[model samples]
Target: MAQDIGRVHVIRHLIEKSRDRKIKKMIEKMMPILLVLAASVCIATTFGILFTLVFETFEFFQRVSIIEYFFGTEWYPFSSGNPSFGVLPLIMGTLKVTIIAMIVAVPFGLAVAIYLSEYASGRTRKFIKPVLEILAGVPTIVYGFFALTFVTPILQIFIPSLKLFNAISPGIVVGMMILPSIISLSEDAMNAVPNAIREGALALGATKLEVALKVVLPAAFSGIIASIVLAISRAIGETMIVTLAGGAMPSFDFSVTGSIQTMTAYIVQVSSGDAGYGTVIYYSMYAVGFTLFIFTLLMNFIAHKISKRFREEY
Candidate 1:
């Protein structure tokens, strides 16, 4: 009877193993199809948005001169009588804010990342990193209001020339908004540097700073640059902060502290039920949006290229 029971148990174990193998094989067969489906969804969404933007933008160009849209310095598309469709001023404003944001974010963010990656104790890092990254979850509208009600007031004390509503105020707030992304990405990259490399450098009596700045930084350079590029892309696409703190004047000017309207701000202005449907001004918003999409797409492409080129292999 014991032998009969052992035989039955052995047969059941074989059956279970065979069933597991069959299940594994089935999953393997479906894996490629599942992955293809996932990739197709992403591709389809991208093409869908591109098609929408292109169709509307082509319609916009039919109502406005492409050359004027690209080269004209002033933007007064909503003027009661002689509405001009030039978009350069909006472009200038966007660039001004983005440039200022990078100026504030890059050096300071990188410095924080380095300190967190190389110097901080494990307990300190664990405590501080979450606190710092919590900034990412902060609503952009809050940042916009803070820029208007807080940062601007502080800046006015030091630089009395600063305007109540200007590019610099929003730019600073956008920089703060982008800070978590920069620090998180850069620290991840720096942390990915092998312990062996640090040990190898230290074996030669190199100082910790030297090891960090020279060995770790070079290895992590690609990720660091990618972070900065992403931060720039993030800044350029921002709307609420720029719309609230950055003034609505779409005038092409080089003054950092002056009132200017970004592409995003202009889009908001037009979309606020100000422009009638099917009007030239309404179409111009699509054109401006397309321009912004292309600009951000180009920046992301460049970042992808940079990170791809310099990706370090272990």
Candidate 2:
């Protein structure tokens, strides 16, 4: 009887093992289908957005002259008499803030990235990296309010010409908001440089700083440029900080201390129910969004090209 019981137990264990193998095979077969479904969702969403923007922008152009909209300098879409729909001022505002943000973020971000990748000890990097990432994760609305209440006031102390709502404060805050992207991505790129290269340079009597600047930096150039481009795209799409702190006054002036309205800010204003649905002003929002979309797409394309062109093979 004991021998018969052992035989039964062995048979049951073999059956269970076979069933587990079948389950594992089934899961492996399902993974590709699941991944394809996820990719399809993303593709569908992108097309949906593109179609919406195109349809609405077409409607806007039917009512407003495309030539005037593109080349006209005035942008008073809410005028009581004749509302102008020129996009130049909005474009100028967007570019001004973006330029200022790049100016502030690029140098500082690259410097910090170099420091973290080349000089920081493992423990120090662990602490500092998380802090920078946390700063990045902080809500943009908070940054907007910080710029409006804090930075603007501080700037006013130095430059009495600074307005309560101006591009400078928001530009600086946006720069701070995008710092983590530049720092984290650039540092990762720098770290990806082979240790063998560093050793080889050092063996030839190259100093650490020299190796980092001349050798590692050139090797990581593509990644750093891609990171900067991504940051520029983020700065362009930033809405709350520019809307709240950069003011709602659209202007062609490039002065950093002047109040300006970006394409996103104008979209916010139009979408805030101030313009009735189906009004030309409401349709103008789509036009602005489509324009913003084009700018971001161009930036991404440039990043891809630069990454591909300058990428270094291991």
Candidate 3:
């Protein structure tokens, strides 16, 4: 019995030593390659997407002038005589929808985050957060269908001219789609505020609301803003909901009641139909996609910069 016990101890020590050495070597070997691999993957993916968009966009621009694509008000590439290829209308439509979405999402998302982080009990927060995440996990196509089938009809009650697929419903749904992202991020930021700060605020005789609004919120402002910017970028890049719900007609008007097409919607419309390669219509999709890609990229870069500059210290 004594001999066996000694052998087991020796074996366990050997195994522990082996594991420690293995883990240390793994970390040492991986440390350098980690950043390189990350950068390489990012560049590769960016280049792949950018290259395809640029070449296709270049082909598109050959048929359509840069000026026309940028400043043109009408977008009817399929129409006959005097077809206008102005991309401004589509840009305006995208902006209108995004603005509406931001308006709907930001306040509610931030409020929910504050409530969850500052007010909710542990049990309530645990339950509510999963439910919120589930909201995000719902397939966007379902939301698109809901917008088309339900939201538009509801809007039609107030606005007779509202089409089967309009910006209002989809924009609202897109806002809902992005709400969980914003809330989750913002709550994380809020929760990162040190307990000492909260206690100090309470020590100063400030109410919970006052402490949260004036102290904790300010401390976490950078993270909250970063979350908002990221959410905006997400809204701009959203495709399925906008495509399935927003009507596929690119227009220059800023009216929410009117049917308008986003950059993503336009791409989907073109890609859905049969257009042979090397055709103007085919190239046009690339050009629109390139434009959308650049727009989203710019937003992402800005958001990244903001996040880096304002990321929480601890």
Candidate that would win on TM-score = 2
Per-model TM values vs. the true structure: 0.86, 0.88, 0.85
Candidate order by decreasing lDDT: 2, 1, 3
Q: Over the stretch 142-211, how does candidate 3's per-residue lDDT look in tens digits?
A: 9888888888899899989888878899999999999999999888889888999999989989998998
TM-score of 1: 0.86
Q: Which TM-score value belongs to model 2?
A: 0.88
Q: Whose lDDT is greatest here?
A: 2
Least accurate 10 contiguous residues by lDDT in model 3 = 305-314
Cα lDDT over the full model 1: 0.91
In the range 1-314, model 1's lDDT, one tens digit per residue, is 99999999999999999999999999999999999999899999999988988998999889788998899887888788887877888999999999999989998999999999999999999999889868989999999999999999999999899988898999989999999999999998898888999999999999999998999999999989998998899899999999999999977779988798999998898898667888888888889999999989988998888777766455
TM-score of 3: 0.85
2 or 3, greater by lDDT: 2
Ranked by TM-score, top first: 2, 1, 3
1 or 2, greater by lDDT: 2
